[model samples]
Target: MEIARPQTDARPSPVRGPTPGAVLALLKPITWFPPMWAYVCGAVAAGAPIGERWYLVALGILLAGPLICGTSQAVNDWFDRHVDAINEPDRVIPSGRMPGSWGLYIAIAMSGISAAVALLLGPWVFTAALFGLAFAWAYSAPPFRFKQNGWVGNGLVGFSYETLPWLTAAVAVLGHPPSWTMAGIALLYGLGAHGILTLNDFKSIRGDREMGIRSLPARYGAGMAALIACAVIALAQAGVIVMLHMAGLDGHAILIEALVAAQLLLMVWFLRDPVSRAVLYSAAGVGLYVTGMMVAAFGLRGLAMPV
Candidate 1:
């Protein structure tokens, strides 16, 4: 809801239509990389020649990052505007760059545009987009607002960002459901991403507690939240490693193990000072994590290598 402010002078207010930059800021493009990367991984893991349906790959990436993911960011920023006023007053909405309910309007418009694009992709991608948009709204809007709880919110976002894009891309390129191996790997990576998203909560722990948002750090204290994050991430990564080995991708499995070993060292530091080191781990640890995702994808391609 837009709040009314009292006039103190006859001068005009800066409130007006949002500029293109403000709209972009509201959409938060920096947050789009994860889903885009996941989409590529999915396409790769499908073992189809990328050059054959390169257009589908391009469209899927666009849908994952700019269209679908961008709408989700807009929705989240709109709903979190009040909270941002407390923790990040300079964000577009709170900063008055996006004035007078423009954020909500932009979100709605983007959702419609995203739908049209997804429809062009095909039935599999379209269905995933519907569920993706639904969860995007449900994660932020009233009566649901899954973002209020760390467990539910993290799981929703993790799956929506990682698994949804990954699986959708696989089907978009392959024109059918992916194999169980591909699906299971996507699930494992998505679960690990839950821990990654949880790390984002540490920055606003105080505001989250003050505003009744039940982020893991605010709900269970930062130290415990860090431990839980590490455990979830490590366990998910371990699952991928075991599955890779079982699939006879021993070389890839060893590489992922080395990556996880590196992340474990960073996790130790993150646990020591979670509030301060969460971002550090997110950058360093998550780099290795996503690296494993691509490695796993490439390894799956080996399954179809020449006999």
Candidate 2:
């Protein structure tokens, strides 16, 4: 078997420091919303009074979104700089906007900061943060660079992005583990987000294949990968609806079912040209999916409250 290597660009002289804008670009601020929203959902699902610990809520959000998630982005960019050279040459690291080893330094610094913030939040939050951090590194770094395989990579990202942050937020507020219902909802959403992560791989199929990354789009071909992504997302949400209905959350179940129905309709259109329509489905269909996550979280709030 021929070994494939990531294509790299000529190294430039290390810059003194990256500009603030470059640093922010490397962190990918737009990517922060999913985990931040998941944290908010978890907090709400915990059913604790926010009035008493507004500061903790804010801190938890910061930890989950900008600190932890941003660190992961930095780590990924650092390790995948060569890959980006092929897929997105203009990205900060490859373009030398972040320059030299600054990306690695930033990832390490943010990892420490995230740990400190998680420590202040609570033991459970700290534990979850540690796990998230571990997966963050494993997803991008070699040896266990999970990103080399689509199923493992996407699953790890989804869990770290959705479930871990949700659990951390719940623990931060409640000072204890979340209820079974809350945990179940978070897990289901996390599983569904695997499809979301796979959708992200669509744009980089060529680079992935060239570099032997084995992403879903690269391995199964775009059409089959699209079908698999849609099926996984639908099945996870279907499980959520059934669980919610059986738990006496009829209103929430009905709302989620409606959302799933709308997503299925969109999926039909998306399947027609999965490669071109992936981003469109991500924006529209995935938007509905996350909204339904919030709905499920709210339903669990009632169960979390003191009876």
Candidate 3:
């Protein structure tokens, strides 16, 4: 009797080993820092006009924005195991430190806690939290796989990351949803996030291409992708200046615009290369500029309109 030989299959060995700090890194806890500042600015913008409680708004930022974002990141890492295996083998699950299911449970639990906080704020905040959770889920899940949906994916993640936090802060203080000024801040931040996401795609171009992912860098070459990143940052900066001027927040605008221009120039130079270090620096720089601008705007506005 002739037996068919077992088919020969060749693939890289599955990555193994537990990283003790896997869960910490898996959450990308650092990413939530900038969003917290963004929400604080939103709170300032909301309460500045009529003078409202800012501390509660800040608390909302901590509980709703960063907490939820961290949880969502864990969920993202869990669902993205295959992609991570190819794009970032040393990551938490791919590296074998934490189990994928555990990550999912952690994300779910955190999301629940965050939603409870949102409910304490009000109905609008609760609605925003729900939307954010949905976006986070779809970002890496199979049905409506935003990560593979190109620009659509980027927009989903970007909007949730930047917009919802600001809206939540505004709602926490203003007792309602986003106002025109709040919307402007969201738009500006969202654009910057879009650039960051696109730039990140450049680092994973090869893996994305091999995995049939439709990321910006895979669809467009790295050079063009970086150029797009620069353009997005420019537009985001321009939006901030325009919004500040339109809102008649002139005193705040001057300082914010100057800082933004400096940051923009840095981004332009950084985007000229797809080097890993450049990308990392660019991400950090964006975070710094946003935080600094928020501080300058809120600080000056508060002083200028002293009660």
Model 2 lDDT per residue over 159-248, tens place: 999988888788888988887877888898999999988899899999999999999999999999999999999999999998999899
Q: Given candidate 3, what's the lDDT at residue 93?
A: 79
lDDT of 2 at 181: 71
Q: Residue 174's C-alpha lDDT in candidate 1?
A: 82
Off by over 4 Å in 3: 1-20, 48-55, 292-307
In the predicted model 2, the residue pairs found to clash are none
Candidate closer to the true structure by TM-score (higher is better), 2 or 3: 2
> lDDT of all predictions, in order shown?
0.93, 0.92, 0.71
In model 1, state the lDDT of residue 84: 96
Residue 227 of model 3, lDDT score = 75
- Taking the tens digit of each residue's C-alpha lDDT, what string does model 3 give over 1-307? 9999998768877754336477678778677875676677667656545345645776677764567788778878888788788988998878767863777777788888888877776787788778888888888877877888568888787777776676677667766665666576676777677877776676677788887888887988777777776787767767776777777767666776777777766776676666555466566667656764575447434543548
What's the number of clashes in each of the models? 0, 0, 2
TM-score of 3: 0.82
